[model samples]
Every structure is written in structure tokens, then in C-alpha cells.
Target: MYFYNLLSKLKYIFTLVITTPYYGWIIFLQIISGFFSIAGIPMLIPVLEYIRTDISGAEKQGHMGFFNYVFSFIGVRPSFYSVLIVSSVLILLGQILVFVSTTIAQFAQIKLSGEYRKKLFNSYLAVDWLWLTRDKSGEMNHAIIREVELASVAHLNSQRIVIYLTQLMVFLALSIKLSFKVTMLAFVIYGFLIIINAKNTSYVQSLSENFNETFKRLSTLTANILQNKKFFKSSIAYKGFVSKVFHCIDQTMHTAKILNIREQLQISWTFLVTFTFLICLIMSHRILRVGFSELLVVLLVFQRLSPQFSSLFENYLALNKNIPIHQSITHRLNDIKKNKELCGDEIYQFNKSITFKEVGFRYPEGKRVINNINLEIKPCQTVAFVGTSGAGKSTILDLILCLLKPARGTIFYGEISHDRLDIFAFRKEVAYVSQ
Candidate 1:
């Protein structure tokens, strides 16, 4: 089950990366930068060893094969200053690549958010009125604003996870070269820690989902209040509406507080475990009979690995939290596509008169608004529907304007049936004034 969930999360990350433009370039840059960053850490070990040796010594005491190979490759003699310069150069190059990659990733994130927002907006515009009316305007706004932003952040975090994983692999490889047993021990300890915290990760995901629901409710409530503030304030229901808003806000805040506490606890626990591991490495050096230089390198590697582990866990939790938002957006887009307004090819032209022959209309909720209505009006003729508010006056107008299709019978533009006429082109001939 755990492995299946892990694969699912990985697939989500892969889909997100693949959908974004220039993501290939971003991953490539991240890999190169991660290599440089972890590769530079091991250089410090050789440089430290070179510095500890006598300046005029004919040979070094510790293993210098790695440095010797690097120096030979660069056609430079193995000296303290030479190794130090190369180490600094490698670290600097890593930082430079990191800066470049981060800049591009950030740009990609912004572009992605904009593209998603635009796509969602276009979907809203293209969707039929029936589906649009069924959805809350506030929830749609929240998806376009908050949900998209969170999704973009999730994408960025996924990229960071990639970079961190790459660096961790490099660290592991170097640590193994220095001291295989210690490296394996550290790996096992960290893996155990992850297993221990798996439940917390799942709990955080639940809290995130709860928070999303509460916040969306809050957004919808506030939007409703804003839209009808005058009516709400003048009516006796003002207190009730206000109380509901406050309740939603409280629920949202409560969920957020718990989520933050869980995250902090995870961080604290990770730190405690990492500190204990570091202490064990220091104290067991004698028992392991590990050489000073190799032990120091292993320590350095583990020290860096600790934070990478912590970051990976943090990002994983965040990714899980935001996955629902992405899923919601996908579902929304699919619904919009499914509910797209119907269109026809033939252009509508007004000639002679408009006629409704035994036309009937009813809403989806079984509201029979119009029934068997026969109507006709010539071009340039002014007509008024005289009926009470709940009557089918507006429904008849909508049928004429092609905003609503008839449930039975046929409406015609001159001799052409409404179904054969392009609704958009038909609307072009209409000049409506709404109250």
C-alpha cells in the first residue's frame, strides 16, 4: 500500500513537470547544479588533509588519490593552495548554477500560474449558463486565485525535491566511498525516521483537505455577503449571516493552527533524530577505528544529508496537501468541457417574423416555466410580456434569444427551425434590455 501511494505521488509530480513548458531544461539544470554542490563537499576533505600536512613534506599521510586525479586532470600540482582554489571554484560554480536554475524555475512557475488562470477563465466563459449557474461564483474565484497559486507552489516544491534527492544521492555515493558502514547506518536511521513519521504525513494531508474545505466555505460566505450586503444589513437575518461567516473563519483558522503544529513537530522530531545520529557518529569513531579524515568527511556528508532529508519530507507533505487542489481544478475543467454550450453552423437571419409553435420549456429542477406557448412577432414590432414575476415572461424572452432551448415543439426564425440556426449568430440579431 505504501509503495503504491509513493508511486502515485511520483506520478503526480511527473505529470506536473511534464505539463509545464521548459521543465526539461529546469530538471537538467537542477541535476548539474546538484552534482556541483555535492561534488564540492568531498573536495573539502582532501583540502583539509593537504593543509594538515607539512608545507615542505615530500608526501601526504592521508589518501590523496581523489585529489591527485583531479589535480592531474587539471594539469596542476597537488598543493594546499591549488586544492583550496579548486574547491572554492567548484562551490562557486555550484552556487552560480543554483542561482540560474532557481531563476528559471521561478519564471516557469509564474508562467504556469498565468496559463492555468487564463485557461480556467476561458473555460468559464465557454461553459453553458446552466452549469455556470450551478457553481458558486466565489468557489470559482477561489480556484482561480488561491488554488492555482498553491498548485504553482507545489510545482516549485516538487522541483526542489528533485534537486534535494539528487544531492542526497551524491552525498550517499561520496559517503560510501569514505566509509561504507557508517554511510549505510546513517541511511538506515534516516529511513527508519521516515517510516516513523509516515502517519504524521498522512495526518497533515487530512488537515490540509479539511482546511481547504473550510477556507472555500469562508470565501463563498464572504462573497455572498459582499454581493448582497445591503439586503443582509437591512434585513433581520444580518446576525445569522455574520455568525455563519465567523464560524467558517474560526473553522479555517483552527485547521490551519493544527496543521502548523504538526509541521513544526515533524521538524523538531527530525532535528532530534539527526542530532542523535551526529553524536553517535562522533562517539563511535574510535569503535569503528575510522581514520580522522574519512570520519570528518562522513560527518560532513551526514550533516548535509540531514537537512536534505528534512526538506524532502517537508516538501513531500506540502505536495500531498496541494494535490487535492490540482485534482479539483482538473475535475472542474473536465466538467466545463462536458457542459459546453451547443452550437450549430448555419447563420441566423431575421426575415418576416419570429414564431414559436407549441413551444414548451422547463428548468432542470422540474420547474415547468412555459407550456405549449404559441407566439409570433414581426420584425420591427414592439411587444411586451404582461405577467407577474414568477410567470414565464422572461423564459419566453430567453427562448426567443436562444439563451434557453425549448423542451418540446419548435421555434423558428422566419422559416428556419431554431436547432438549425447558429445560436451565437441568432443572438447577434437580438437587442435585450435587462432589469
Candidate 2:
């Protein structure tokens, strides 16, 4: 059950929290963009092979793959300069596609972020008032505002994950074509780092939630302190104010620093692997007597792939950090509909007297606030109940509107019971003015 809940939240972050429901085309664009971003990765192999063997103004070197096809299209004896131009053009096209793909990712992210906020806000409106009242002011404020922003970041990170994963695969494929030994070394170094990081994912996740909860508590505390500064000041409560909470907040911040350090290490470990791979490649070039151009291509590919891979790694850490906000949002909509007040078909008539017969009320798990009240209000009557603060004035008004049902007794709306009437229609007929 616990694992299923976690999986559900992860799924929610990807579909509901990060993107719109109608995101099939957007996801298709992501895959296509990812493909285009790495188009140039393998082009160098065929291009360089063509340049080295086929067009060196010597014994004819055989052409293959894309380069071979292009030469076939030209259908004439080609100059060395023409081969260079063809390769350059292919690389240029790849770069253009990469740029276009990036633009598409950014555009999709903007559109998805807007859609998530709208979807979440609507879900908030549909939540049960009982659940809504458990938190401060309508909803968890961050769930509406701050968490939505985090969700935008989540979208951006997810896009990076796709793009960078594609780039890594392309680079590895090219490296394998160049030399199996060099590729293995590259794989071992980076793969080890990923494996080590994966083992700590649970710890990282816990830190994420701890940081989120602590920061939320601190935010609430700060808001309360400011809003009620007069009460706190007069009560001599400002001196030790927030001391324990601040300690908790500070510890959470320290945990955040630890997480950041780990993320930095994950990224730095990649750089270390890159440099190590470079050194190993140079040694292999000297020992294996491989062509410098070929080795250089492998080295350049690794260098290019590293930054994207690092970006991907950092984004993974960031995504983990922000997923709690995603889960909180999905929780709002999940299994919550059953708790909302159900409406009846009947609408109460207000033509006759409304009666509260030995009506009693209390919040769940609390002492009764409205106790055994017997009252009646006739049509066109003006009546008021005077009470001190903490009295049940607002509770009585809420009961009249059918917002709160009596705990132990009955309330009647004209000739019908309150529960039988449609609360929305009943409330509409009555006017409530609150200051």
C-alpha cells in the first residue's frame, strides 16, 4: 500500500502536476526534440570516416551510411573540399534542429505550467469545506502558488531528463563505434556514480519532505507572528518567539545543505569521470596506435555529453526535492470527493417557521459548542442571539445554512428536515453578511 501510494504520487507529478491532460502532442514533441538534439552525435563518425579514407587525394577510401548516400546523390567525382562542405552542412542542420527542439520544450513548459495552476485551482474549489478548514485560509497556500511554481521547474527538469538521456545514448553509441575499450572505461566510471546515487534515493526523498514541512511550518509561524504582532507583544511572547521552531527550521536548512552537497558531488563525479576518461583515451591512442582524429572524436563527444549529463543529474535531484509539493497536490484530489457534502433533490421552503428541536452541535472530537438549542424563526421575523466571544453565534448561523448539521437533535426547514433539502438552494434563499 505504501509503495502504491508513492508510485501514484510519482505518476501524478508527471501527468497532472507537470503537464496538461491534453499533452500527447507535447510529449510527442519532446521525444522528437530529444531525437533531433542528438542527431549530430553519430554524424561525425560517418563524416570523419569519409574524410579520412574516401577523399584524401590518394587511394579511394570507401564511403558508408549518410555520407555514402549523400555522395551517391551527387553522382559525380567529388573534390576533397566538397566532402568537407557536405559534412559541415549536415552538422549545421543538426544544430538548427537542436535549437528548434529547445524552443519547443520551453513553449510546452510555459503552456503546461499555466494549465497545472488552472487545474489545481479548480480542484481546490471543489474540495470539501471540512477538509479545507483543516488548513489555514481556504487551502495550503503553497499548494496553490509556490508548489505550482515548483511544478514548472518539474516540467523543465523532466524535459532535460529526456533530452540529456537521449544525448548520453547517442554519445555512448558513437564511443562504442570508435573503440570498445574506451567506451567501457567511460561507462564504468559514470555508471558507478549513478549506481551509488541510486542507493541514496530514499534518504534524499526523506530530506526533501523534511525540508518542505519545516519550511511550511516556518512560513506559517512568520505569517502568524506578523498578523498578531500586537497580541504577541502585549503577552510578552516575542522574546522566546519562534525559538523552538527556528531550531527546527535551522536543522531542516542544514539537511537541505547536505542534499545540495550530495547533488554537487553527483555532478562533480561526472566531471571527474570525464577527465579520467580523457586521460585513459590518450593512453589508449598511444598504445593502440588508433588514429588521432578518431580518438579526438570520441573525446569531444564525451566532453559535449558531460554538460548535458550533468544538467540531467542536477535536474534529477531538483525533481526529487520538489516532488513532495506534487504529492500534496495530488492528495487534494485523490479520494477526496467522497467527503464533500452531498446534496438532496429537495429545496427547502421558507414560507413557514424554521424549528430547532433540542438541537445540539460540536466539531468532531471536541466539546459541544452549540448545546441543546430549541429555537424557532418564523417568516418575516427578526431575531438575534447575543453572546460573548467563543459563544456559538456563528455556529448557529452555520447550522441555519445547513453548513453544519446538529450532532444530537433535529432542525427543520419549514415542513421538511434540513438534511432532505438541497443545501445550495437553501443557502441561496438566505442572505449571510459577515464582517
Candidate 3:
């Protein structure tokens, strides 16, 4: 049962990620960049072969691709020097493609940042008054500002992950085409190394989650401490606040340290594995009499592949880190959508008295905030609710405003229950001041 539950949650997280906002054109650009990146791999093969012997003979005898033909048609001779320049320029162009694609993707993210914050704010405004008071506190403010920002970032980070994955696919395909046996051997070694470091990835993800939680708590604490600074002037209150703040910071630093250590360990492990693979390739080449050109190409692939895998791994971890923020904001938005305070179809025309009759209310903890309250107010007549703090004054006004539904009895505008009145129109005609 636990395994199935975990499986379901994993499915949901990935589904949420893929469904997040992404620019289709930017993704297409990255896809094109992937091909551009892969072109350099094949272009290197002949260049390496050309370097093994006489450059003129190697170039005159070697097969060249369409790019070589284009250079030739433009009056550039096909030779080792030409192939060398072509490969370097092609790689440079690929870098440009990646840069251009990332820039556009970032632009899309900047546009979405405002949109996501607006989405969260509008959702907050639409939430039932009772729900806000009932649910857990400290999550709302940070989620609205910080987590929503993180959510906007998820689209950009997710796009980067997709681009990395695309590049990996292209690199792997071309490396295999260039030298099947070497590619297969490298894949096994690197695949095994990745499996070994999979636990580290999970650990990093766990640490990221802890860091996110700590940061949110810190935000709440900072706000709370500043608002209640009077309490903190005393040594006892100051000590308590300092203790909590320090604990949160200490925990955050500890988690960050662990993540950093894991990253270092993973990088060190990748270096060791790649080095071992190179040695084994050399030994295998000596036995199989593999061509030097193949060795050089394989070495080139390994050099690029090592960093690719490392970055891809890091990006995968980023996906995990961003998932919670996305889910936090999205789940809140979705919950509001599901449990919204729906308005009635009735048009509100209030020119008479608003009355509350035998209304009772309690909080989620089952403590009554308002009990058996009765009040009435007429048009053009101002009234005040005067009570000590935490008395039912604000709750009563909220009840009158239709922000909170009564647990017992009714609130009426004229003869109609407030629920039947158009809430938007009613609120527009009414306003409240709070303590």
C-alpha cells in the first residue's frame, strides 16, 4: 500500500511538471539546437582521422558531409584544416543556438512571473473567508510571494531540463554511430555510475525540500518577529525569537552543506568513472587494434559526455526541487477552484435594513468566535462593533459581509438570505473597517 501510494504521488508530481506553462516556440528552438549540437560530433570524426596522417592525403581521400560540400561550393577546399575550422565553427554555432533558445525561454519566464503572481492573488481573493481562518497559517504569505515566484521559475528550469535531455539523446546517438563498441562500453560504465549516485540525487532532493520548508518558516518568523517587536525588547522574548530563528538558519545551512557535499561527491565520482573508462578503452584498443582515429573520437565523446551527464543530473535534481513549489502554489490554486465561495445569480438591490438573527459561529478548533449574535443596520445609518480584541467584532462584520457562512441561524439583506443575494454586488455596496 505504501509503495502504491508513493507511486501515485510520483505520477502526480511529474504530471504537474509537464502541465506547467511552457513556450512552444522556445521548446522548438531547443529541439533545433539539439540537432545543431549533434552535428559537431560527426564532424569531428573525419577531422580526427585527417590528423592521424598526411593532412592533404587524409582530406582528399576522406568522405565529407553536406557541410563540407557547402564549404566546397563556396570555394573553401575540403582538407584537414578546412574540416578543423568547420567543426570548430559548427560547435560555436551550436553554442549560439543554445544561448538564443535559453534567452527566449527566460523571456517567457519573466512574462509568466507576473501572470503566476496574479493567478495566486486572484485565487486568494476568491477563497472563502472561513477557509483562510480555518486552515493552517504561515503558508499563505510566503506561498503567495515566494512560492509563486518559484512556480514561475519551474517553467524555465523545466525547459532547461528538456534541452539537456535532448542534447543527451543526440550525443548518445552520434557517439554510437561513430564507434559502436566504444559507445556501448561508455554507456555501461556511466549508466552504472549514475545508478550508484541515484541515492545522492534522492538525498539532494530531500535536502532541497527541507530548505524550502525552512525558508518559508523563516519568512513567517521574520514577519511575526517584526510585527511583535515590542515583545522582543525583553530578554526572555528576544531569546525565544533568536532561538527559533537560529534553529531555522542552522537547519537550512546544514541541509545546504549536505547538498553541496553530495554534489562534490557526485562530481568526483564521475571524474573517477570517466578516467577508469578511458583506461579500459586504452587497454581494449591495444587488444583489438582499434584505430587511433576511433580512440580520439571516443575520447572527445567521453569529455563532452562526462559534463553532459553531470549537468543533466543536476538539472534532474532541480526538477525535484522545483516540483514542491509548483505543487504548493498549484495545489492552493486548484483547491480554491474546487472549493471556491460561489456567488448567487440574484441581483442585489439593498435599500433597507440588513439583519443578523440568532447567528452562531465557531472556529476549526471548535471554539466559538461568535455566539447567538443579533444585529441590524439600515441604509445611511452607520453602526460600530465595539469589543475587546478576539471578541466577535470582526467575525460579526465578516458574517454580515457574506465572507463567512453562519454555522447557525441566518443573515439577511432585507427579507432575503445573504446567500441568495449576488455577493459581488453586495460587497460593492458595502465595506468594512477592521482592527
Candidate 4:
């Protein structure tokens, strides 16, 4: 259910699933290989115990299930020795499969990470100029890098979730073979672990925001140093720039240290639960009158289950933490996307002159950058505008180029409001080279 919500927002889910055979194939193979490894565990403990006792006839008792089924099919009676040999082979093969699968996943992760980074870069490149000015360069850097890193981390962690889920299932089957009561106890403990981790979602989200802010401050500090290097090196300002970078780094480290401390505290709770589970096993052994093998089975099951459950909860918390950052970055990106210039519109056709009639303009904040004005230009005439600095000269050019729309009056080309003309198309027909 956690994954259900997680996967819902990532647009790349379909791509990830469809490419699973391509990207996550090794992981799937490892899971299949791991099943054999888990099943062999039950067989192993008994064999070793029998060997320790030096019993001669105990050989027949150890060889059962898959070993017997496969060997019997091949018209061979799998001796205790033979089953032991076969199980070792299966275990070795499974180990190799898991290693290879993880290796492949890491490689695929790098490729996908690069692809996403490229897409983000292209999206930024295609957007309008306004975004470049509105968003500080450092903040954009912070957002882009944070998203890329998270996407990579999430993708890798997501793959592991599959591996862990497979391992859990194998362990669940083994636990069922041991005792239904023990398995149920383990399941309840796992559910509790999940709830504990889920409760930390708000903290995780807050941490993510803090992390981004730290990086942004650092990025801004760095950018300023680079841009003002001359000013820094020429005067006593060098110390000031150095001080700012240190200040940002100091804040970044402070937040980071707090998060690390919290994580360590959380780990203590895991240890507490593990100790409780161990106590539960002891009580269950005496109450249920379970044999040594059954006790060993429960212990082994808990050994695997504790780490699995703990990891599941930790990963969920981490995912929740990262999702908010991912969402924030995406929101900014989408805003940039929405602010993009319109494409594929019909080019406006004008055969006569261009004119501005009783025109006026003001910025969005209502600072009047332009005053009432009337102007005309013939189809093929060269004209010049003369005015002092801040005398609405640049504003007039901005209005004509359609970079800024006038708040009052009209600009006409052949008696039509120039606003109706495709601004992009109009710009192509007329070039205004500015100083």
C-alpha cells in the first residue's frame, strides 16, 4: 500500500515496469535463486545437528522435499550426502545470481539517472526567459540536483524493496512451516514496526525542506563568490565572502547533524523491539513445548525477519521523506513548464505600417514605466527614438517587441491591435538591436 501511493506520483512507473525485463531482470533472477537458498536453510540445520550426533541412519531422515523430488525424477535416490551436496550447489548458485542482479540494477540505475537529468535540463532550456530572472540560479541548481539525486536514490531503493519483499515471502513460508502462532507474532511485530516508521513522515518532510534550503544557501554563497571574485580579491570583501560560505556550511552541517542524531535514536527503538522479540521466543518455546529444531526455526525466522522488517520500515520513512522534496521540485519544474511560451501558433500577416495609439504601460507592481504616447512607422521607414535615461525609452521598445504589454491604449499594425498579431511572429519580421 505504501508503494501503491509512492508509484502513483512517479510518471516513470510505467517506464520502470515496462523496462523491468530490461533494467531489473537480474533482480528477478536473484529472487528466484534466493528462494532455493531460503528453502535450503531448514534442511541445513538438521543435517549439521545429525552430523554432530554421529548417527548412522539419520542420513535418510535429512533428504526430503525438493532434493528427493528432483533426484527421484532423475531415477536417483538422493542420499543425505547427495542432498547436502545439491543444497550447497543451489546456495552457491543463488549467491551468484543475487550478486549479478544487484550489479545489473546499479548499472541500470546510473543510466536512468542520467536520462532523467537530461530531461530536466532540456525542460529548463526550453522555458521562457522570465523563469531565469524570477528564480535565483542557485535555487534552481538546488532543486535540480536534489531531484536528480532523489530519483536515483528512490529508483535504487525501489529495486531493493522488490528484493526484500521476495525475501520476506520466502521467510514467511519458512515461518509457517515452523508454527502458525510464531509467524503471526512476527507479522504483528512487523506491522507495529511499519506504524512506528510511518509516524515520522512529517519529520522526514521537514528534514527534506531543511536539506534543500541548506543546499540553496550553499549554492548561492558559492555563486556570489565566483561572480564577485574581483571585488573580493581587491578589497577586504574577501573575508566577507569567505564568512558567508562558512555560515551556510555551518547551518547545513547543523541540520545534517540533527537528522543523524534522530536516525540514531530511531535505531535504538529497533534494538528495543528486537530484544522484546527475543524474549517472546523464549516464552513461546516453554509454553508451546516446541522442540529444539522448532526453537531454532523461530530464532532463525526472527533473525531474518527483524532486519527485513526494520529495513522495510526505514525505507518507507526514507521514501516519505524524499517524496515531499520530489513533489516540491516537480511543482517548481511544472511552474516553469507552464510559463513556457506558446508554440505552433499561426504567424500574423501584416502588409502595411505599424502604429502605437495613446499607449501607456506600467509594470505588474504598477510602477508606470511608460506614459501616454502616440507613434507611427511606415512599412519600410527607418525610425529612431530619442529620450533620456528612464524616460520611457526602453519601455517603448519593450512594448513594440511585445515583451511587455501596455496597460492602456493600443499598438496597431494596419489598423489592427498589434496584440492580436502573434508576438513571436512579429518579432521575426522586425529586429531591434539594443545597446
TM-score of each: 0.93, 0.83, 0.84, 0.75
Worst 10 residues of 1 by lDDT: 54-63
**Candidates' C-alpha lDDT:** 0.80, 0.67, 0.74, 0.68
Worst 10 residues of 2 by lDDT: 57-66
Candidate that scores best on TM-score = 1
Q: Please provide, for model 2 over 95-172, each residue's C-alpha lDDT reduced to its tens digit, 9 standing for 90 to 100.
A: 565566556666776776677678766666455555666655423665566766676666666665665676677667
Better of 2 and 4 by TM-score: 2
lDDT of 1 by residue, 25-113 (tens): 87787678767766677767766666665435235514466668777887998666776677788778976876787777778879878
Model 1: residues with Cα > 4 Å off, grouped in runs:
55-58, 66-70, 428-431
TM-score of 1: 0.93
Task: Give RMSD to native, each candidate.
Answer: 2.3, 4.0, 3.7, 5.1
Candidate 4: what lDDT?
A: 0.68
- In order of lDDT, best first, we have 1, 3, 4, 2
| 362-384 per-residue lDDT for model 3 (tens digits) | 87678899778788888777688
